[model samples]
Target: MSTKQIEKSTTEIQIPKDVKVNLKGSMLQVQGPLGKVYKNFKKIPVLIQINDNKILLRKTGERKKHQAILNTAKSLIQTLCTGVVDGFTIKMKIVYSHFPVTVKVEAKKVLIKNFQGERAPRISMIKGDTKVVVKGDDVIITGPVLTDVSQTAANIQLKSKVKNKDHRVFLDGIYRYSKSKGIEE
Candidate 1:
């Protein structure tokens, strides 16, 4: 299909009552009851407009890449709005078959102890305002921004990664079980 046939794409997202949006150049900031999120879209050439309680994303180009960028921008805006209202949480479970693994949350890092019978604890750095909580074998990660919450969970899971081992035999690692909006109960 011709690029001209692709057509321009436009998307609108409804803003919550307690959420506020601010735009400056290619930077967008969303503030809500939970927290604030800053996103930079300098790489994408699109127009973002905040009107009343609605956010509008528009891409005039008919190129496939432009359409993709528009969709990604729309999703990012929606995620930012949801995060302000409900926040975000990622639940992870620690699994160890051979040796029991101990998980601890220190300052800005998550410490993995006794993983694969290792003497030194593996450290996972926590970024942004993400918080990690260890309850039994369950790890609850929470933050206002989705990226921060997901990144922290990934860090913990990566720390437990077993290299040069069989996946079926050595299935001991931190695994993300579920992800949801709002704080953990």
Candidate 2:
């Protein structure tokens, strides 16, 4: 009996007009009108290639683990492409039932002053290359990378989380309302 090997799984993504994808060894960089995003896939068990205006990602074997990684790489590359072009943004709203919470961006940290009438300010570190802006009751987080932008927003939300109290009664925290770049929940 002759043994047959399964074909590898492949995924293709079309590149946009205003975006440029550069592959240097294992590092992939995408630059576009919005900004640039870079990621390393050296340790992943997958192959990435840019052909013309398309991106090809494939796995050598048909194992479950390899397939998972292949899909992850594909999604990451697609996110990078979208981020570089349209960019990523998260909108958060500050709501306070009792004490008004003041948000400020200081250096690489977000300072939450007078949260729940606390004496000291709660600090949250900004991750990656994310930019945070406070306008009245609205908080805008923007970045070329989706992960960084979302993480930074999450950090702010977590920092102002209400502890040891009823969430319904004490609704004084920063909450994410919307997310852009084709990613929303």
Candidate 3:
């Protein structure tokens, strides 16, 4: 049996007019109306080219792992485009049995108090320029970078996890209810 050899592959990403992308060596900077985002692709064995309104990610390797990395880079670039342009938002809801839980946004971290009637407060570190806003019973998290915004939301959810208690019955914690940019539940 004869095997066909693939010469090369490329991924193209189209961006909006208001967004600006700059590539300096392995570091990429994206600026938009919402904010700015930066990513480093130092280890990825792929070539990145940016145009006026589009980007091209070229992959020349035929290895399976290389293909995976190229796909991942492509997806990451797409996310960066969307995040810089439209931004990302995640909404969480505070639910408790009786003690009542409160979420506070500090300078660089989020403090979750009275979680499951616990006296000690749980803290979640905010990444990048992610903003956490506590309004009534809703916690709104927004940012221009997908990684930062999603990581902050994950930190908050994981920090308030119910320990020792049965998860099905003791559902008293901060749970993500809604989100944008394909993040939900």
Candidate 4:
């Protein structure tokens, strides 16, 4: 290919001081104080390099496709590294005026019972290695992966959704109160 037809870009991601990153071929493994995470870039059209505490992503040719892959890889690598170090937390509270709601965590699933006085229990899925803790009326979802934690929280909130009910009148369901990095001590 001619140089004029090729596109090129370079992205650098700095590794955290307390985190250790290992790259073997197209797979990346990051270990930190909180947990370990793995990411694969095997099919992506980009070059990866690791030196000391930095990671470099290089893209050449194919315009936007290659550039997008490069940016995605860079972002995923950074997110995994940061997640393994600081972790992610999503806090939610159960709100019901008519009937009390109860939440229980079982394996990779969560059961929400008595949601708005519904006889059939509502179910939500817990993704990856996420931990769900039900205390009083508060539901706390936590994990090393941001996607897993956030998705789990979303699932729980969505499952308790009311249909055909006025949102202002029926403020009953699990709702996210706060989202933050790092676990509560």
Candidate 5:
């Protein structure tokens, strides 16, 4: 019989002053001035120990994959800290091929008109302190948190996607240009 061996590593992380961390089982909750965030991990072999002002992550067993999990956990913690401290932002651009599309923000809804010359205008809901604005062909989105801002922008882009058509031929749609403090494509 052949035996399999695994290796593991350890990492330590410090919680920022603006961030508050609460742990129960494999679930973690981080709260700050901006908002509260929650995350759950399944069968995490690593051990997380919290002291007075510091949080430590220790990898147990001999599993090399635990290192990746530890890094992901550290990243999530860092994101929570930064998000609570300064928040995040995302930006998108609206383009058109045949007809120019008009983008506008009204109250808590973002409206898109003349898209593919559709009879009805498309709308997307805005959340929290997120704001959507149209400056020429550029759509600017900002919020106190990354999820709200990025999701709002994505919703607008998804609503404008041209389905069952060649992307090169029918290129009139909204697209993401840049993202800050959050995931963007």
Candidate 6:
């Protein structure tokens, strides 16, 4: 088999003062005023280097798949930096096909009720600092960091996923419409 060699690009990004990063193997642990986060990239053929003021990720090898990995790594690093510095947020909407759904936040958990006409409410685990609020049909989830916020949103959506049913007919699920910083949903 033959492989193609491609030129890699180096992107320079500034790290916030509050954030601290440590690299061990393919795992990168980042901590900041918002929270602490860890990202593992075992399959991505890349090198991560942290400097006094910036972090660099370089792609190695000749496989075309490395291009996607490189981009993903870069994005993850960017998100980490931003999240540590300012933080990330995700907003979602709860839609119902027939029954009206209601969501609320209690302590560190999100309470979901009336989903699919169920009598029992479903609870979504939430972090301590993260805030979950409900207004009409919109459920707003916010966190000091990106991973926690995104994971909480994903859990809500996953819990509403219908099984053995046509999605076109049953579209009652939590849907993401937009994100902070102008990122597409």
> How many residue pairs clash in each candidate at the backbone level?
0, 0, 0, 0, 2, 0
Better of 1 and 5 by lDDT: 1
Global Cα lDDT for candidate 1: 0.88
Residue clash pairs of candidate 5: 6-62, 7-62
Question: Which stretches in model 6 have alpha-carbon errors above 4 Å?
Answer: 1-11, 95-100, 106-109, 125-130, 144-148, 161-173, 182-185
Local distance difference test, each candidate: 0.88, 0.86, 0.85, 0.87, 0.75, 0.75
TM-score of model 1 (CA atoms): 0.90
Q: C-alpha displacement of 5 in model 3, angstroms?
A: 6.5
Give the lowest summed-lDDT range of ten residues in model 4: 1-10
Candidate 2 whole-model C-alpha lDDT, 0 to 1: 0.86
On residues 77-103, what C-alpha lDDT tens digit does candidate 3 reach at each position?
A: 888888877788999898888888988
67-130 per-residue lDDT for model 5 (tens digits): 7777777776676677776677677878887877998889999888888888788988887677
Arranged by lDDT with the best first, the candidates are 1, 4, 2, 3, 6, 5
Model 6 poorest ten-residue lDDT run: 1-10
> What is the clash count of model 6?
0
Q: Candidate 1, residue 86: CA error in Å?
A: 0.7
lDDT of 2 by residue, 66-149 (tens): 888988888898888888777788999999987888998999999999999999999999988788889999998888898899
Question: Taking the tens digit of each residue's C-alpha lDDT, what string does model 4 give over 2-67?
Answer: 664443477789999999999898888899998788777888877989998899889855677878
> Which candidate tops TM-score?
1
Candidate 2 deviant stretches above 4 angstroms = 1-8, 182-185
Q: Which ten residues in a row have the lowest lDDT in candidate 2?
A: 1-10
Q: How close is every model to the real structure, measured as TM-score?
A: 0.90, 0.88, 0.89, 0.87, 0.73, 0.70
